[model samples]
Target: MTDPELPKLVLPGEYLGAAEQFLPGRGTYEDGGRIYASLLGVPAIDPADRTVRVEPRNAVPEVREGDLVYARVDELKTAMAVCTVLSTVASRRQVPGAPEGTVHISKAKDGYTESLAGEFAIGDVLVARVLQAHPGIKLTTAPASLGVVAARCQVCHALLTLGEKEAVCPRCGHREHRKFAKGPLPSPSGAHGPGGV
Candidate 1:
């Protein structure tokens, strides 16, 4: 049978063909008698065996436990801080889907965390370690090396500068407490650089 017309490139879960017409192959899955693309790639059907497959164009970066990652705090709850994982620190690649990660108050710092608002503010960029990668992403900023790497003043929204014991906003002169990561900010270019901020 001749191959059916298919999109040049397909996204994950895009319908491809009927399972009866094309055998499910690599990067394709069969479900309810239908074939679907399993990744971002070009879809094709093998004429000889009638196998449908998607040739991956780019590899998706996987997040794993113990990996260092950069994330932005989106919301602060009583017991946890919700964040969107931005990228993997080592690879410096943006995480696909922008998975949500949470930092429990107990893992916010080394000791007791009186309030999530005290340590993290909305839009604060954090450098945290992945404590759990599956089921749901769990993060930890308790280590001195892992915490808010960049934060803005809550009052004026000016970028805060590192100070003796807290972050200071030059514009508003507002001082805020944070569990700062013990290193310099990652370069705007997404590369790691030296010198503490």
Candidate 2:
């Protein structure tokens, strides 16, 4: 007679009901004839299939279509720029090691994204909408709520005010252009505690 035990897959943590595999990485498990997150990885859970969850290893952050994400500008153009996704705000420890994404100027604000400097610079962080995702995230700042989070003087790196028409550095009087938000946006550099939003 042979013994039958539970379908033990190689990974850790209890079954998160069900899970999905985004990429292949260390400490993963297979359950119900499928793979899922088994460690600190993308926030994926299946409701129907009860399986162990796991995570994959990569380099950059992954950006999905229609996801609100935080990103920093690596480079910019007259109409577009490349962005490195800083992290996922809505979910916990979202995908680890995805890839860098792109932010188009046409989508930089709600009204007219007439100029790139009107919203961002080489180092400004942005809260943006993911309009589409190719190899990289197609980003949008078209929402009134989405745009530059912090303003720095391009010349002197002084902190600037989130003004009605644009961001101005009080110390240097350097004016930065941007599509206006009603008031200042909540700080993006604020620290997030464990399981914090």
Candidate 3:
């Protein structure tokens, strides 16, 4: 007899095999006497269990309230900074769907924030805690461990190194004040600075 068919890529609604031969698993559905792919993925056949499943490619995790996240400042406003969440700290997976998050000036630091411009700048990457994920994602950097982890020099566009009260650019010697997080900061080599996160 000929060799059995190998698993192959499949699109939604593509027929997989007869339902009697293989039970439908994740990313698959059973219709009539046939199993079909329900998502864009590769069809996996389990000969032992006689099951068929479609493993989706690049499955990203969704954000949730209370999750720590890494985000880049997209826009700075008078009262808030609009940030696009890059990933969640726990899963390290790119946030799916609406990744836009907002951090009000009051939530930027623990004590108080005089102005949003004074505390944050566009393109700054920070660690934050998800305060709300309902109507829209709301973030807070009020904890000592949460705040600007990395930033670029506004004047020279070079990566800023962590300083006592702010970040300083080695290229331009430009010092910028930010609500820096407590503890260690991320370095250019992608490693944590002394005593930093």
What is the clash count for each candidate, in the order shown?
A: 0, 14, 1
Ordered list by TM-score, greatest first: 3, 1, 2
List model 1 lDDT by residue over 1-197, tens digit each.
22449988899999999988989999999999999999999898888888999998887777887778999999999999999999988889999999999999999988998999989999999998788899999998886667988899989999999664599899989989988888553433222234211
Across 1-197, the per-residue lDDT of candidate 3 in tens digits comes to: 11156356778899888988888889999889988889988777777787788888665577777777899999998889999999988777788764899999989987778998888889999888887878899988876677888899999899999776778799999989987777743332222235322
The alpha-carbon lDDT assigned to residue 149 of candidate 2 equals: 74
TM-score of each: 0.67, 0.58, 0.69
Residue 68 deviation, candidate 3, in Å? Answer: 0.7
Cα RMSD (angstroms) for every candidate in the order listed:
7.8, 11.2, 7.7
Q: After best superposition, candidate 3 residue 51: deviation in angstroms?
A: 5.0
Q: List the candidate 1 regions with Cα displacement exceeding 4 Å.
A: 1-56, 184-197
| lDDT of model 2 at position 156 | 89
Candidate 2 — which residues are off by over 4 angstroms?
1-62, 92-95, 180-197
lDDT of each: 0.86, 0.59, 0.80
Judging by lDDT against the true structure, name the best candidate: 1
TM-score, predicted candidate 2 vs. hidden true structure = 0.58
**Candidate 3 backbone clash number:** 1
